[model samples]
Target chain A: MERVPVLKIGDILLVSIQIDMEDQVALQLQEDLAERIVATGVHGVIIDISALDIVDSFVGRTLATIAAVSRVLDAETVVVGMRPAVAITLVELGLSLPGIRTALNVELGIALLGKRDVGDEPADDEDEDDPAAVTTS
Target chain B: MERVPVLKIGDILLVSIQIDMEDQVALQLQEDLAERIVATGVHGVIIDISALDIVDSFVGRTLATIAAVSRVLDAETVVVGMRPAVAITLVELGLSLPGIRTALNVELGIALLGKRDVGDEPADDEDEDDPAAVTTS
Candidate 1:
C-alpha cells in the first residue's frame, strides 16, 4: 500500500499527489493527512493535484474529508493545481468541494496561507486608499 | 463611465469584469446583472473576475448578492479567475463570497455553467461504477 507523503514547510503541510490514486489510496491519504495535521499543529495544508487527469467522486470526497478534518484541527486546506478537465468533471459529478479554498498553483497556495497568517494588516493598508473597504454589516 | 458588458452566450449570460472596480461600480454590476438575468431568461451567469487584483468586503458582498439574485431568477452564477491575492484578501476581510460557484478560469467557468444545464445526467453515469456516489441526504 503506497502512502502519500506529507511534507511540513514551516508551519504548513504540503501533500503533492504524484500519481493516479485508487480508492483505498485516497482514503489512506485522508487518514494520514488528518493525523499529520493534528501532530504537527500546522496552520495550513496545500494539496497539489496538478498531475491528476481524472478525479472521480471518491477522490473528490476524500479531498473534502481531508479539508473538513483539517479545519476542525485549526488548519485551512487549499487544493491547488487542478486541471481544467478535472474541475469540469468534479463539478459535473455534482461535487463542488465546498469549504475548500483553491488556487491556481502551489505558489499561490503558499501565498494564500501566508496572507491568512498576517490577517487583516495587509488589507488595512489598502483600506487607506479605498474607502469602500468598510465592512458591510 | 465604463459599464461591465454582459454578453449572452447561448442560454447563459457571461459578464467579464475587465478592470479593477470601485464599490459603486461593483454595486452597479450587481444590479445590472440581476436585471439582465431576469430580462433574458438565461439559465446561468458567469462573472469573470480574472482582471481584479483586490476584492474588498463591499465587492465581495456584491458578488454574493448577485449570486443570490440570480438564484431567485432561476439562473446559476459562477465567479471565475479570482487572483490568489484577491482571494487571500477577501478571506482575511471575513468574506468567503458564499453561494457562488467558482472556477479557475473563464473557460472552466463556462463549462461549469453548461454542466449545470445538463443537471445530474452525467453524474448518474458514474454512479453505477462508484457506490459512494450516493448523495448523502
Candidate 2:
C-alpha cells in the first residue's frame, strides 16, 4: 500500500499511517511530519496506525525520534488505533516504543489533548485504582 | 509524578503520560479512554509520554488492546512522544509496546487525527523506497 497522507485539522496536523512501518519509511515519515508540523505551527499531533501489521526495532526507534523532534517544534504527539494482535505480538517479541503516549482510539486521544479544559476529570474509576498509579517510583 | 491529565482540544483530546505503563494501568486507561470517546464523540486522541522510565510486555499488550477497542468505537488512536533511550532499553529488555497507530509527539499525533476527515491517503515518501516496506511475508 501507499504511504498515508498528511492532513491539517484546525491547528493540529494529522499524520495517518497505513502500512507496516519499517526503519527507513518511519524516518522519512517522521522527517516529513516534523517539517509539516513546523510549517503549520501545530502544537498537537495524532498518528493513526490502525492498518500497520508488523513493527520492528527500526520503526520503534523512528517513533522515539519523531517524539523528540516534535518537542523541539513545541508540539505534543499521540499515537492511536493500534491492532490487538500486533500489540500482543510486540509484547511477545518484547519490543517497546518507550516514552510514547498511547490511547485506545483517536477520540479519546483528542479528549486527552485538552484533558484539563472541559472534559470530565480523570475519574478514579475501578480501573484507575491501579496500585501503580498511586505508588511513587 | 501523577498520571498525566487528559487534554481536550476543540474536537480532539490529548492525554500526556510519563509512566512505565504496567498492564493493569494500561488496560484501565485504554478502556476508560474508549468509553469516553464513545460518550463524547470527539475527533481524535493523543497520548504523550515524554517521561517514561521503563516498559514491559504487559504494557505493550494493554496499549494494543486500547487500539483495537478504539477502532470498534469508530474512533482512531495514536501513540506519540517516545524517547530514544527508552526505546533502546525496551529492545534490550525484550519489551515492546505493540504495533499500533503511533507518532513521535502530540503534534503529529493530533495531525494524524486532523487529516482523518480529509481521507488519509497513503502517500509513500522516499522511505517506502526501503526494501523493508516490501515485505515478503
Candidate 3:
C-alpha cells in the first residue's frame, strides 16, 4: 500500500495524489492528512488531484471529509487540478463536495489559500505578475 | 408558468424558489437571472432553496449554470438551505454543483455574500453576536 505524501510549504500542507487510490488508501490518506494538519498547525491545505482520472463516491467523500476535518482544525482546503471530465462526472454522480473550494491548478490553489490566510490584504502583488493569477477568475 | 421572483435587497439579488421547478421553469429562471445580474450590477446573489425537497440533474445543472453566468457577470452566487437528504441524493447521483457556494440557511448565505462583497472589511460585527457565525467554521 502506497502512502500519499503530504508536503509542507510554509504554513500550507500540499498533498499530491499521483495514483488511482484504493478505498483503503483513500481512508488512510484522510487519516494521515488529519494527523499531519494537527501536528503542523498549518493554516491551509492544497490537494492536487490532477492525476486522478476518476473519482467514485468513496473517493469523493474522503475528499470532503478531509476538507471538513481541516476546517475544524482551522485550516482551509483547496482542491486543484481536477480535469474537466472528472468535474462533469462528479456533478453527474451527484457529489458536489460542498464546502470544498477548488482551483484549476496547484498555483491557483496556493493563491487561494494565501488569500484566505491573509484575510484582507490587497490581492497579492505577485499574482498580477503571473499568468496563473488569471486562473482564479 | 410561475416565475421565480428575483428580489433586490441592497446590492444583492435574493431569489427564493418555492416550487419543485420544471425543466422549462429552471431554464427560464436561468435566463431571467442572468439578465437581472447584468442589469442590476449587484455584487452578490442569494438563492433560497429551502422549499425544494428534490433536485434532479436538470435542476442541478441549472444551478451550476446560473453560478457560472453570475461569475462571468462579476456577481457571486450562494445557494442556501439545502436539506441533508437532498445533498446526499445529489452526491449519490453524482452532481456536486461545483463552483457554487452553499450555506446552511438564508442568513448565513447572505453573510457569505456580504463578506465576498466587502472583500477586506472587519468580519461582520453582527456575525459575532449571532450564534450562526460559528457555523462558518
Off by over 4 Å in 2: A1-3, A116-137, B1-137
TM-score of chain B of each: 0.78, 0.69, 0.82
Model 1 clashes, total count: 0
Residue-wise C-alpha lDDT for candidate 3, range A71-103, written one tens digit per residue: 888888999878899999999999898989998
Ranking by lDDT: 3, 1, 2
For all candidates, the clash counts are 0, 75, 15
Winner by DockQ: 2
Q: Model 3 misses residue A32 by how many Å?
A: 1.3
Docking class of 3: incorrect
Candidate 1 per-residue lDDT, tens place, B6-59, comes to: 655456676656445666777777788888877877778877675566787767
What is the Cα-based TM-score of model 1?
Answer: 0.44
What docking tier does model 1 reach? Answer: incorrect
**lDDT-superior candidate, 1 or 2:** 1
Give Cα-based local distance difference scores for all models: 0.75, 0.63, 0.77
Please give the C-alpha DockQ score of model 2. Answer: 0.02
User: Candidate 1 chain A vs. true chain A: TM-score?
Assistant: 0.82
